[model samples]
Target: MAKKKNKKASPNTIGTNKQARRLYEILETFEAGISLLGTEVKSLRGGHVSFKDGYVSFHDGSAFLVGVHIAPYEQTGQYDQHDPERRRRLLLHKHEIDVLQSKVDQRGLTVVPMKMYFSRGKVKVQIGLGRGKNVHSKKQDLKDRDIQRDTQRQLASYK
Candidate 1:
């Protein structure tokens, strides 16, 4: 008889924007509900979401998530299919929206989607208020990461 491999499953993480941390200095984060279509929610549950090049924008005092791609559900018929890159509304309190609007008005500060995941059976997005990192800062971050990695490796070998 063959032995079964029982692997531990990770907590549900639909997708994350790895590039966001590298490109931006995130100052604060917020968890906001996403207004998703039926098909879109199904696709996200199936782990078909992309945050690459995705950003947040506001209009008429409402926040919108733009550029994030949620692949349509494979089983859904054409008539019920949702657009892959539609602008989805984000549910935030009025005060939160006002704060975000003010921060975005500052020079070089903007909002971006950091992660998408399911929470308590509902799809949610983690958005961040960030400033774009300059070249020197990026280089410094890379150097610090390298140093940390080296120290961890040395400690592990000694142990």
Candidate 2:
């Protein structure tokens, strides 16, 4: 008998924080694993998560995902329900944590959760270090995007 080979599948995105991209100019991003309870995982699989006001925070040499809401698993018993707004720990190396902390403390950059997805069988969060964009910058970004879209449309029509 021949041994079987296992193939890896592409990651499945659970949710994204669109507001973060629009409101902040991302400078750097890091992928970190998230700690979740059984019910939380189930709820996430069911696409019951909100990224509103979600961001990363460092404390005591550890990173945490805060202000994100993961809805409770609907079929779970009341006793087994998990808190929807708990601050979950983010799994990152000591060096990575230190780097993030330093950047935050020194540069005054904010760490926000950009995306959440399942890589292999585990959940991962893509955290971004960013500075908040001013209103003028945000408007300029919108104008640039509109111009890019018009150019693309004209080129597509020519094709």
Candidate 3:
């Protein structure tokens, strides 16, 4: 008789953050593990989280994720529900944390959330160190995008 084949369940892989469709520039992206409670983890698995208010800060040789909201589990009650807007710690190497800290201190770079996803059953947040876009720069980006879209549409029509 042949042995039965056992199949392992697939690990969850999905983005849980607002994607910037027209990101003018992406400087650097860092993979950092996120600290989450049981309920928070469950909420992320549902995949409706937002990064509109998410930002990262370094303190005491570590980076912390601030303003990242993970809503409470819908089926849970208030007794054991953790704060949805709690500050979560980001797990990164000591050297990497130091580098990010130095950049923020020396330069005027800002830490912004690029995306959030699950890897090997652990939730991870990708942070981007970026310089803010000025008004004219943003307008130029919009115009460039519009031109690209128009070009693509014309090419499609000709084909």
Candidate 4:
């Protein structure tokens, strides 16, 4: 008989956004394994995930990722469908939780999801603790971004 072929796997870098990076400054980043169902994993692998409206929350000393939607895999069985928008648990260390708790206790900070990537064949979410940006600050940020992009474009032309 021919030898069995083990299924191959690859880690994909699902690029994040400016908000994730901007907040990553004061934001302590902690990687945690996310709980996922079979279809959820398949959908995430198929790039059917979104973190735009997602936010992290702490409950009973455990942090969770909420509002992240991973579409159901179409090839799966029909009866036991997993909820796409259910609250998913984030696996973090005790010390990390303690530190996050203190920072979250402060009025201005909130936890945000940074990136989600596969690690050792399991999906992981990178969460961050950060303070919100005011309207003026957001405007200043846009200005800075435009300036940076212009500088990069100018440099590219000279090359």
Candidate 5:
């Protein structure tokens, strides 16, 4: 009889853009593959990524991820490492890109990167179509979140 190989448990999520959620009202989300170099992939696996100010831009009928930072892999030589803040190409179908571009152009909405995760051994990005929220709405969202947290705490205590 052959022995079974043990599989290690690991989380699929690499990082999330919490600021994007707090600043924008997300309307729709689409999953797309990100083009990354080897060192970038290693850094992502170690959770060394920042999504601050990350957004998607359409150019010549293709979408690109911008403003995101993937830290350089420390174990690799300097020359072998990838840029920490380079624009990455996103793999989306032509029709999907067209739809997002149309929404951005016609509705004045923004395309932001919501999260990045590994799916079936491939890295995937979750992009959201969002409208920028005003200061008052952001404050309201904070208040509502606090209220919901308090209610959940009270319910848990009662139980």
Candidate 6:
């Protein structure tokens, strides 16, 4: 018998933060380029990225991604290994960065990384500006989701 290979040709999405939608009300979204090391990119391609605590922050007139974890590539040598928790710089137009900064400062909003994916062979991140949802609103959203699910099941049964 021949051994099987589990490797996929290519994956569309690298990672996603599922809690972003449930914890915050997204106001705006922007696509930004991420600066990654060679090994980090390989790790991402292998589905080893995490976004649970990832967020975007501005410093020195530039944007940086914080808390996003990319596991080191398994084949990398010890001398060339990259830090999993190092802050990565984000590439965006100066005007966009200014706008994001102003909105975040004035409205007390947060910038969170919603998803990471490959676009034309380049890694990109979808950043969302969001306002934290309160407990009551979260409950309402859960209730609405349940109702929609129940309606979908009913419609399916009727058909």
Best by TM-score: 6
Off by over 4 Å in 1: 1-9
Instruction: Tell me model 1's lDDT, rounded to 2 decimals.
Output: 0.90
Regions of model 5 farther than 4 Å from truth: 1-10, 157-159
Give TM-scores for every candidate, taking all chains together and pairing residue i with residue i. Answer: 0.91, 0.91, 0.85, 0.81, 0.89, 0.92
lDDT of 3 by residue, 1-159 (tens): 999663323345445443342342557888999888999888888875777677888878779998877778898887989887788999999998988888888988888777777888899888888777777888898799999999999999999
Q: What is the TM-score (0 to 1) of candidate 1?
A: 0.91
Evaluated against the true structure, the overall lDDT of model 5 is 0.93
Best by the lDDT measure: 6
Better of 3 and 6 by lDDT: 6
Shift of residue 147 alpha carbon in model 3, Å: 0.5
Candidate 4 lDDT by residue in tens digits, 46-114: 778778778888888897889887888898888867898999988888898878878888655788887
Instruction: Tell me the whole-model lDDT of each prediction, alpha carbons only.
Output: 0.90, 0.92, 0.78, 0.77, 0.93, 0.94
Point out where model 3 deviates above 4 Å: 1-24
For candidate 2, the lDDT comes to 0.92
TM-score-wise, the better of 1 and 4 is: 1
Backbone clash count for every predicted candidate, in the order shown: 0, 0, 0, 0, 0, 0
Write model 2 residue lDDT over 1-159, tens digit each, in one string.
Answer: 998663222338888888998999999999999999999999998778899999888889999999999999999999999999999999999999999999999999999998888988899999999999999999999999999999999999999
Clashes of 6: 0
Per-residue lDDT for 25-101 in model 5, tens only?
A: 99999999999999999998898989987899999999999999998999999789898989999999999999999
- Tell how far residue 120 is off in model 4, in angstroms: 1.9
Descending-lDDT candidate ranking: 6, 5, 2, 1, 3, 4
Model with the higher lDDT, candidate 1 or 3: 1
The window of 10 residues in a row where model 4 has the poorest summed lDDT is 6-15
Cα deviation of 138, candidate 6, in Å: 1.1
Alpha carbon deviation, residue 43, candidate 5 (Å):
1.2
Quote model 2's TM-score. Answer: 0.91
| TM-score (C-alpha) between model 3 and the true structure | 0.85
Residue 67 lDDT (model 6): 96
Between candidates 4 and 6, which one is better according to lDDT? 6
What is the lDDT, from 0 to 100, of the residue 3 in candidate 2?
Answer: 86
